[model samples]
Target: MAEVTAEARIEAPTGKVWERLTDFGSYGEWNATHTNFPDGGPETLAAGSTFTENMKLMGFPAEVLWTIEELEDGRVLAIRGKGPMGVIVGTRYSLAEDGGATKVRIDGEFTGAAVSLMAGKLKDSATAALTESLRKLSGLVA
Candidate 1:
């Protein structure tokens, strides 16, 4: 298994940050790993919602069928998904309001026989992507 976590303190309220982060239509504009969302972001975010997303990881195009596992409005959103080659992937986005700023964190995990083969490279690539995504997101909302 490989895991990566990244966080950023954006100069904006949690509600403002959450609104931009969950905006599926503009996702490609600020999200670093986004390639496309065939079905788009969830019409409404809830625990049982599902979405199909196409993304690039380690410069390889892959698709993930994701099911929302948990939701807490502007505070948390977690999803578990199946990716190419039988890999299981999970990502969690957490937000907290700190005065006028929001502290956002993204935690991701990958597991499967395929993941083991390139765990080191995958971790590095994923970490960089997450960090860059947060930077872009921050710029958009802050």
Candidate 2:
């Protein structure tokens, strides 16, 4: 398995940050790995809701079918997906209000036979993408 995480303190309230984070319509604007939502994002996000997203990572494009595993309004969102080559992917977005700013963190996990073949490179790529996504998200909301 390969795991990656990134966090940032955005100069914005948790509410504002959460709005942008869940606004899948504008996801590509700030999400570095997001290419597009093939069937559009979930109309309502709740545990068990499913969505399809196209993503680019490590110079490759893949389609992932994701199911929301957990949701806590503005606090947390977690999803698990099935990707190419039988790979399993999990992502979680966490937010906390800190003073007037928001502390945001993204955690990603990848597993399966394919992941073992490229764990190191995948970690690097995913870490970079997560960091870049947080930077862009901050730019939009902060």
Candidate 3:
């Protein structure tokens, strides 16, 4: 298994940050790993919503069928997905309102037999992607 995390203190309000975070239609614009959503993304991100997205991880293309596990308007969103080769991926996006800005954190976990082989490389690539994604998101909203 591989776990990765990244956080950023964005210079924007939580609502602004959340808007960009949950804007699935434009995910590829700010999400570093996103390529496209072939079947489209959730129009509403409430719990139980499902979406399919194509992404790249460790330089390999993967299609993920994701289910919204948790959602709290502008505060938190969590999703668990099944990727190729029996890989299970879980990701959580959390937002906290600081004094004048919002602190956003992304935590991701990968598990399955496939993950054990390249856990180290996956961790490095995923961690960097998370950081880059946050930077892009911040640039867009913050």
Candidate 4:
């Protein structure tokens, strides 16, 4: 398995940051791995809601069928997905109000036979991607 986490303190309130985070229409603006939502972003977000996302990671493109696993309005959003080659992916976005700003953290996990072959590289790439994503997200809402 491979795992990565990235955190950033955005100069924006939790509500504002959460709004941008869940705005799947504008996801590509800040999410580094996002290519597009083939059928468009989810119309409503709720546990068990599903969506298809095209993404690029480690220089390879993949389509994932994702299910929303958790939701907490302005506090959290977590999803798990199935990708090519029997790979399973999970991502969690967590937010906390710190002072007057919002502290956002993204945690990602990868598992399955495919991951064993390139766990280290996947970790590095995902870490960088998450960091870049957080930077872009902060810029947009800060």
Candidate 1 lDDT by residue in tens digits, 81-101: 999999999999999999899
List of clashing residue pairs for candidate 1: none
Local distance difference test, per candidate?
A: 0.93, 0.98, 0.95, 0.97
Flag the better candidate by lDDT, 1 or 3.
3
Q: List the residue pairs that clash in candidate 3.
A: none
Tens-digit lDDT track of model 4 for 10-97: 9999999999999999999999999999999887899999999999999999999999999999999999999999999999999999
Q: What are the per-residue Cα lDDT tens digits for candidate 2 across 1-142?
A: 9999999999999999999999999999999999999899998889999999999999999999999999999999999999999999999999999999999999999999999999999999999999999999999998
Q: How many residue pairs collide in each prediction? A: 0, 0, 0, 0
How much lDDT does candidate 2 score?
A: 0.98
Which of 3 and 4 is the better model by lDDT?
4
User: Number of the top candidate by lDDT?
Assistant: 2
TM-score of each: 0.97, 0.99, 0.98, 0.99
Off by over 4 Å in 4: none
RMSD per prediction, one decimal?
0.7, 0.4, 0.6, 0.4
Off by over 4 Å in 2: none
